[model samples]
Target: MAPQGVAIIGGGIFVKEEHLPAVLACPQLSLKAIWSRSIKSAQETAKLIPGDASTSVDLYSSDSGEGKSFDDVLKRPDITGLIMALPITEQPAYIEKALAAGKHVLAEKPIAKDVETAKQLIAKAQKIAAETKATLSIAENFRFVQGYSYGAEQVKQLGKVTGFVVRISWSMQTDNKYLNTAWRAKPEYQGGMLLDAGVHFTSALRKLLGPENAVDSVIAQTSLIQSYLPPVDSINAILKTKSNVVGSFIFSVGTTLSAFDFLIACENGSVQAEGSRVVTTRGAGQNATKEEKTFEKSNGVKEEVSAWAESMASGTPNPQQAPEMALADLELLEGMLTSGDKDGARQKLELQHHV
Candidate 1:
């Protein structure tokens, strides 16, 4: 089969570092063009596409002449797909336009700035997809991470889930590259850094718990400890998943403390995932058996893009990257913030995904 030509629609940090490498690594995809809001940024990204690819890849931007604008990229017949990583609030319109132009889209996560917008985009995309057969796949790298999948499978085999705990903390300092983005610095969106970063954890949590034990509700207390990260930067919540299983979720990106792990205890054993490692313990104290496994450290962008390309080729959407799945992750994070604002009033998730 011939490789599908695709364009990248964002020329930011992640587009240069993660998406570029991922696209280059996928043999099924041909790097065709690059687009950004500025010509300089688009040219900067084009420079990273190595040798032969560099010579063939076109650069487009908002400032471009008529034939080299973003709309031109969408009008391209050879470019049948797009890998977009734009700012959260600005992505939906671009996504809709691309799909309407009959191009499959592998869009960045936290589907939208909030749930209502996400739903609207999904509805519009579905209508466009039905007409053009173009697809929308949301990118959530945690779903493709090997450790989380292994941990999730381990949880399923360890019998009924009893309880779980997710504790993660990291400092997003003044000099942090990701935090330096103008949109991220003074996020105009809801939940600020918490919404931007928490969605990944929410996706991981859902993956580890499996569909049968999907999170159903959350009651959380949120606060802004960092003067820089506005609205809120921390969340302490209790999650209730299917089958009445309960868990505690604590996430803070504004603290000096550094830690990260997700542990699920079951009737027969417990599985924990930390970074690229998975550890499991089974049986009673003295007689217990324990094992640990490590996976190659990766951002999971390669596997995710590979999967997205495969889905495009097969004409079947990858369930993991479905807009519904991304919506679920955003819904969970938004639920936490909504609960936080109401002083820990329980927020029930209506769109929780199963598996």
Candidate 2:
């Protein structure tokens, strides 16, 4: 099959650093165009697409105030898919437009700013896909990351999971280019840095625990230690899954300490992951056996982009990071925030059934 022609919308730091490289690496996808709010940025991003004249990437912008608009890109017969990297608040409308135009869409994570909006967008997109036979997916790179994949497999080896704990902390200095983005600094979305990056950690936890167990309820506390990050930047939650398994998570972007740790304790054994290393222990104290595995660091952008392209070509949705799964991730985060607002009172998580 010929490579499916796709265009990337939103020319930001992530687009330049991750998506561009992934698009170029995926043999199943052909880059056709780049769009940004600014045409100059679009042109600059286009230069990163390593290809000959036959593969020349077109540039368009919403701020151009002149030439082809976003709708024009959607109307292109040659472009059958779109990869959206816009702000969380700006994504849903574009997703609707793209799917309505009968174009497959791979959007960035967290699905939407909140659950209600996510449900509405998902409902509308599903209806369009049913009618037009288009594919819609969320780009959750953590699911494809080498370390997380390894950790998940090790978790399964530990037998029936009883409980787990996740801790991720890091300082976001003012010098960070990505954090300095206008939308991020003064995000219209809830939870500020927590909502933006916390979804990935929640997705990772969900992957480790498996789909059979849904987050049932949560009790949490939130803090905004970072003056620059409005709303909140720190979150600590205690969660209970549908299967009765309990878990705790602590995520902070305001801390000076840097750490990443996830541990799952099961009936027969336990699995622990610290950074890129995963350690599995089986048996009791004296008989305990330990095995360690280390995975190469990868952002999984290429893997996700490849999966999207293959799905578009075969007319099947890649179930790994589907929109529904992303919505579930959002529910977990939103539930925590809501529970925190209620002074750590347990809040039940509401999920929408996806066909």
Candidate 3:
């Protein structure tokens, strides 16, 4: 099959560092164009695409007088797909437009600012896709990470999962490039850094626990530890799964401490994951049998892009990071914040489906 021509819609740090490289690396995908708010930023991002200058990637912007506008790019018949890395609030409209143009879409996590908008966008996309036969996928890269995949497999060996715990923390200083973005610094989007970063962990948690266990309810406490980001910066939540499994999650983007840990306890054994290493233990303390495995480190961008391109070519949606799955991640994050605001009151997950 011919490589699917994909245009990237956002020219930010992640686009340059992750998406661009991933697009370049995916044999099924061809780097076609880049669009940003400004032509200069789009040009700068185009420089990062590896290729001869004679065959340079096209650049477009909302304000660019020389290049094609956003609508023009969407109208182009050659571009088969779009990879969006825009803000959470700005994604739904573009996604709708792209789907209407009959282009497959792979958007970044947190489908929309809220569940209602997400549902509307998804329904519209699905309608267009059914009529036009275009595909829609979310770029929840955590689901594609090799280490997380291995850890999830190990979790399955532990028999019926009883409970789990997830801890993710990192300090976002003023100098951080991601935080330096005006929208991220003073996010008009819901959940600020928490929602922006929280979706990844929520996606991971959902994948690790498997589809049988859905986060039925959540009780959470949130605090604004950092003055730079508004609303909330830290979250401590307890999740109850539909199958009666319990889980705890702690997410902080302002704390001085740095950690990433996920442990799953089951009737037969336990699986503990810290970064790329997953350790599985069974039996009592004295007779405990432990096995440790470390996977190659990856941000999973390449895998995700490749999968998206494959799906676009084959006319089958990648089941791993479906739109509804991403919506479930958003639901969990939103539920946590909602519960937190009510003094850790329990918020039920009202979504009808689970991935």
List residue ranges in candidate 3 displaced over 4 A: 51-54
Per-residue lDDT of 1-355 in model 2, one digit per residue for the tens?
Answer: 8888889999998999999889888888888888899988897887776657325888889887655689889888999899999999989999998999999999998799999999899899889988888778999998888777787777777678889999999998887787899999889988988999998888888877776566788999998888997788888999998889888999999988787888889877888876467888986588999998887767788889998888887777988868888888899899998887788999887762221
Q: Candidate 2, after superposition: displacement of residue 309 in Å?
A: 0.8
Worst 10-residue lDDT window, candidate 2:
346-355
lDDT of 2 at 79: 96
TM-scores vs. true structure, each candidate? 0.98, 0.95, 0.96
Better of 1 and 3 by lDDT: 1
Candidate 3: C-alpha lDDT: 0.85
Quantify all predictions' global Cα lDDT against the true fold: 0.92, 0.85, 0.85
Model 2 residue 122 lDDT score: 88
lDDT of 1: 0.92
**Candidate 3 lowest-lDDT run of ten:** 48-57
- lDDT for each residue of candidate 1 in 176-217, tens digit (9 for 90 to 100): 998899999989899998888889999998899888888899
Instruction: Identify the leading candidate in terms of lDDT.
Output: 1
Q: Which stretches of candidate 1 lie over 4 Å from their true place?
A: none
